[model samples]
Target: MRTKQAVAAFAVLLALAATSCDDGDGQAASGNSQASAAGNGGQGALGSDGDGTDGDGTVAGGGEAQLASVAGADELIRLISNVTTCESPSTDPEDTTFTGVDDTSSETAVGQESATNAEWGIEERATCDGEDGSANGHQLIVVSDMARFEAAFKARQEEEIAAGEGDTRTRWFVGKNFAARIYATDSEERDMLSLGTLGLNCAPGYTAPPNSTTQDALVDGCVLTDFVDA
Candidate 1:
């Protein structure tokens, strides 16, 4: 009977050992699962694909969207018109500063095909305070066909250069479908108008070639800044 009792005790020990091992394995599996879940949570916080891109492939922040905000003529005009401190010159429309240009004019025409263009003049005393004085006024041109406009613009520049009338002192801000000829004598006013108001990026001594297309011109020297609606 004692021997039988010893054997039963040994069996009980074995069963207990097996149960302990099973419990340890289950605990380890649970820990691993929790760790995997935590890792997945971290990835989810970073982005869907572990990068800064959303599920739709767009960047998480406004980086891609802002860069893609290429403004056309209407958008450009709206942005310029939102400037409350400064007033643009207008002859026909007293309230609006936009003056319709003759599409047939060489300076206003875009390409062989017809395109609409409008000009906005910014004088030194056009601001509210009337302190931003410049010897020459600034000009903004909004065009329908930027590509064709760029081509024609280069031709005009070539003609001016050939005639020895090329005014290199004038700073130009070339956008996607708009251009700003900044002649503000005041540096602060120029910055306020070009960089602050219009959000243009200019490169000194950089001009697109006469034969360059709009894409080529933008790649070479032209800048297309972000256009935020007012």
Candidate 2:
């Protein structure tokens, strides 16, 4: 789970623009409360391997970074596809199919960007930084693989079923409360498990109360920006 901090304003966005397209939207995203800093996407972090400016212009992050811009949405997706190429196929709880990176804009918001990952066949919502789904002016941090996503979603669904719950629609969403931890360290193989989980469980659109473990974990285990920043 990437740390959650309201940007106050587009202050950081302006900053990252100057430093390529870093946008600094990822500044407070370290330590325990956040996702793997935005660029944290490694070979699979980038959308595919698009040919446009990864905001970084270089389309090349030296370390194990998710290569922000990579090429364009298509190329970025292709790159992600290359790395996450699994041999077997799995069915999801919703009977939905996850193809991969269909909606490139879901990486971040643009107020009116089109093609959300939900539109695509992803098992879970991605960690797109584009709030409203814009391709630029914001950096998108998406997950590369989907295996873990299938498990998590299915687990959540099973949880609902075991509880004799009705209507899965009201139970899941694509965001999380502050403490939804994926793992102690980066696990790309699980990819964006926490991020996707957060997306599916926290948003208001999903009517279920948040998982108590998730909320308790967040409140009991960490400090929020409001406490530090305020």
Candidate 3:
């Protein structure tokens, strides 16, 4: 009976040891699974491109340095003036040749002179040289406020249609704080001033020419804003 009891005790010890080993293995497997899941989650947070831009092209953290060195209106004007085709770019604060307003007039008068000047506190025109070594009639209007300028631009288009002026053939290349009335003498000059030197692109689902009413088509589409101030 003593031998049988001793044998029974030994059998119990073996069973307990097996159970403890099984439990340890299970715990280890669970820990490994948890670690793997955590690693996958980290990757998912980075998005597909891993450049902080999501798969759907949503930029993370406002997308730094995306404006290609254009930070303000001055920089944008410089960019326009620096076009290879531009021989002599001159800026005039009181010039109203384009808008047909007097230089001695106030901002209100300037606004009344043309629909394009409705919202600009300051309207400076920058003229550059054409391919023929003459004034190309290309105009760049630098404004104080982008929002007001865009609103005025859209309203002007509507007014033109309502008053029998037809579609304004004037193509405007707009940025964060400026607009370019593209009348370049040639395609090369137009491309350089509009998209080549400025590093601009069309907004999604929008194009130039006919769709010039919205900010997406006019400003956001043409100006790279990653460098501009919000």
Identify the candidate with maximal lDDT.
Answer: 3
lDDT of 2: 0.28
Pairs clashing in candidate 1? none
- Estimate TM-scores for all models: 0.36, 0.18, 0.44
- Candidate 1 scores a C-alpha RMSD against the true structure in Å of 14.7
Error of 1 at 112 (Å): 14
> What is the C-alpha RMSD, rounded to one decimal, of candidate 2?
22.5
Q: For candidate 3, write residues 1-230 as lDDT tens digits.
A: 99999999999999999999999999999998888756644223333466455444443333322122245445555676555455456654433345321233354654444444554433555666555674445566666665566555555555555678535333555554566654444454445434422323332332333212112223432332222111
Positional deviation of residue 172's Cα in model 2 after best superposition, in angstroms: 10
> Higher-TM-score candidate among 1 and 3?
3
Model 1 over residues 109-132: C-alpha lDDT tens digits?
Answer: 334222232222221111111225
lDDT of each: 0.40, 0.28, 0.48
Assess the local accuracy of residue 199 in candidate 3 as a C-alpha lDDT between 0 and 100: 22
Model 3 misplacement above 4 A: 1-77, 81-84, 93-96, 99-118, 121-123, 133-136, 168-170, 189-230
Task: Say what the RMSD of model 3 is.
Answer: 12.9
Q: Which tens-of-lDDT digit does each residue in 131-194 have in candidate 2?
A: 2232221112233333333333444445555677533331222222111111111233234332
Clashes of each: 0, 50, 0
Off by over 4 Å in 2: 1-76, 86-159, 162-186, 193-199, 202-230
